[model samples]
Target: MQSLLRWGTERGAKHSCLQVMQDNAPALRLYEKLGYKEVYSYWYRIRPMST
Candidate 1:
């Protein structure tokens, strides 16, 4: 992840974002360590299928 961020910065990338589940503790820790923060929250909704 760090390598990819660095690569993007080298190419003049200004910002980045990612999606992760709120309950994913491990990933949350890793992203926090890498300087990521929770800017906003969201969710997805799907319609039920009829048989």
Candidate 2:
């Protein structure tokens, strides 16, 4: 991700964002190690609609 961040920065990307499943431990650890912080949380839900 460091490399990607560098690429993005070089391409004029002021900030970079990524998406990862909440339960992905290794990915979380790697991001943290690379200085990425948890700015917020996300979730998805399903619902049935009936008329």
Highest TM-score among the candidates is held by which one? 1
* Residues 1-51 of candidate 2: C-alpha lDDT, one tens digit per residue: 778898989999997777889899999999888878889888988787888
Q: How far is candidate 2 from the true structure (C-alpha RMSD, Å)?
A: 2.3
Error of 1 at 44 (Å): 0.9
TM-score of each: 0.86, 0.77
Q: Clash pairs of candidate 2?
A: none
Q: After superposition, how far is residue 8 of candidate 2 from its true place, in Å?
A: 0.8
Deviation of model 1 at 10, angstroms: 0.6
**lDDT scores of the candidates, listed in order:** 0.96, 0.86
Q: Count the backbone clashes (under 3 Å) in each candidate.
A: 0, 0
Q: How much is 31 displaced in model 2, in angstroms? A: 0.4
- The top-ranked prediction according to lDDT is 1
Which pairs of residues have clashing backbones in candidate 1? none
Candidate 2 wrongly placed segments (more than 4 Å):
48-51
* Model 1: residues with Cα > 4 Å off, grouped in runs: none
